[model samples]
Target: MIASTPRVTATHPSLPAVFLLGICALLNLYSPQPILPALAHWGGVTVGSAGLTISATTLGVALTAPLAGSLSDRLGRKRLIVWAITLMVACTLCCVLSTSFHQLLLWRFLQGLTIPFVFAVTLAYISEESSAGSRALVNSVYVAGTAFGGFLGRFVAGTTLEVVANWRYTFVALAVVELVVLCGTLFLLKKEANFTPSRSLLAGISGAWRHLGDMRLLLSFGVGFLLLFQQVGSFTYASIALLHAPYNLPPPAVGAVFLVFLLPVITTPLAGRINAARGPLFTYLLFSTAGAAGLAITLFGNVWCVLVGMALSCISIFAGQSASTGFISSHCQHDRSSAIGLYLSGYYLGGAAGAIVPARLYAHFGWPGCVVLLVALAAVSCVFACIAWRK
Candidate 1:
């Protein structure tokens, strides 16, 4: 007879640790964004080239997510998380020392490579530990922590870059912040009592690969990709746009725009409640429509309208993301880590694409063009959400 994997109920302490891990992972993943303009000036590169900093890290995560997820299944989530953070700290220091754009890209890529282990495992770990009744709530809380981290990473890095006038110093400061988060992650994280190691590494990898055939999972992946593409792409170009005409905001002001991310801090858990009451399909379609509306509103070009649109976008994006992730977790009873990894592989791949594509659209076609592109992506994301609902 086959043996069942052990399951341990999560306690109160586990919640904070998971939240810290969410913060640490997302902070590391997005630290370079608000500073992309500074990177361009520092390296004498174009805006598109500077955008590569965002792409490089996400591409790294996209490439390694499947492998990282499988390994976490084979070893343990906590073990992989420790290694990921250790490598992240090392890579951030390397980024601090980089003398040229190419070197910075290289280090960013390396950092991307390591960071996914933490991201891919954390949601899966939550899935394993929590009961179904509370899963959406806890997952929403974790997502909220990620939203906060995203806001803090951009706010802190952008403000510091404004003062320091050196991108290197900004990264140095971020690395210090990461180090502090690292200590907390190590100390606060508990052992994995719910997960059982795979019989072999190959078995783990095979299991992850097999899930690619799942249509619902595929739709979820598409939703993730489109949502992030809209989220990251809009933010990337919007910052540059704000720095130029119409708004003419300085770098510091542009960074402050990320404070709109505070909207997600509320929206994520609210989304969980909505999802629990109405179901993932209802939650997905509702927030996706909101996201589409938010993007469409940004075409108005008024500063207040833009801020309102951005805030709406933040709320809708996090709500949609939480709903989709919860759907995937509830569906994938086995190899859930691998499924989430694939979902994030799509998510960050969209981010990687967003890092570059929107810049070109902005350069060639202007803000209206970027808006059109994002709105289309959001529309498509809604279609996928509907498909998931039907399937």
Candidate 2:
């Protein structure tokens, strides 16, 4: 008789650890965004080129996600996560030492490479450790942490730049924050008691391949891609737009704009409840449409209107993200880490594209052009959610 993989009754996991996982994973991902315009000036490059700092990190995330998944499946979850965060601290400090723009980009990419180890592995950990009754709630909390972390990163980076008149100090501050999180992770994160490792590396690879063949998973992946594309693309260029035009905001004020991200910290947990009652498909479509409307409001040429729109956009995307990730965790029957990894690969690939494509559009056709493209992407996400998540 063939032996089956061991299963343990799910336990109530540490919600705080999961939250910290999200924060540490994302703390550095978009730190450069609020100061992209200043970076361009400092580097003697165009806005689009400076945007590469964001893109390079996301590209590394996209490329490394699947491998991180496979390794987590073979080795274990917390082991990879702890090691990855340690490496991330080193990379953040390396960014401080960078003498040129290219070197900064290289370190950013390396930093990106370590992130999936924390966030992706943590997702699999949640799926395995949490009971069905509380799974979505825990996941929502993690998303909320990410939203806050994203805001904190940009706020600190931009504020430090303004106060010190030096951008490099921002990296030092990020490294310190990362170190604190790393220590918290060591204390709070428990070893996986419910995990059943894949039999071998070959088995993990074959499992990932099988996941790609599922139409439901594919559609979900597509939705993830479009969602980040809209969020990252809009915010990236919006900072630049605010720097120009009638608004003429300084870098510190632009960072303050990310306070809108705090909206998601409140809305995402609420979204988890709505998703549980109404279903992920309904939740995804509802929020995606709202996001597109929010994008439209940005074109009104008023600073207050733009912030309102961006705030709505931020809330909608996190709600949508909560729904999508919850659906994947609930639906995937096996190889949960591999599935989440594939989903993240598409998700951050969208983020990478968002950082680059919107900048080019903004240069050639202005903010309105970027808005139109993002709105269309939102519409596309709604379509995929309808098809994939239909009950």
Give the top-scoring candidate (lDDT): 2
Q: Model 1, 1-391: lDDT tens per residue?
A: 2125443333556677777777776786777776777788889999768977877887798999888888888888887888888888899889988889999999999988987788879888888777666778778888888898887777778778778877787778877777776777788766676787788889889989889998888989998988888888888788778888788988767777888888887888889888878888898888878877877787787877788888888888889888888888889877778888899899987876776788777878998899898888888888888888664
TM-score of 1: 0.90
Estimate the TM-score of every prediction. Answer: 0.90, 0.90
RMSD of 2: 3.1
Superposed model 1: Cα runs more than 4 Å off: 1-11, 37-47, 243-246, 358-365
Q: Give the Cα lDDT of each candidate.
A: 0.81, 0.85
Which residue pairs overlap in candidate 1's backbone? none
Per-residue lDDT tens digits of candidate 2, residues 70-107?
88889988888999999999999998888888998999
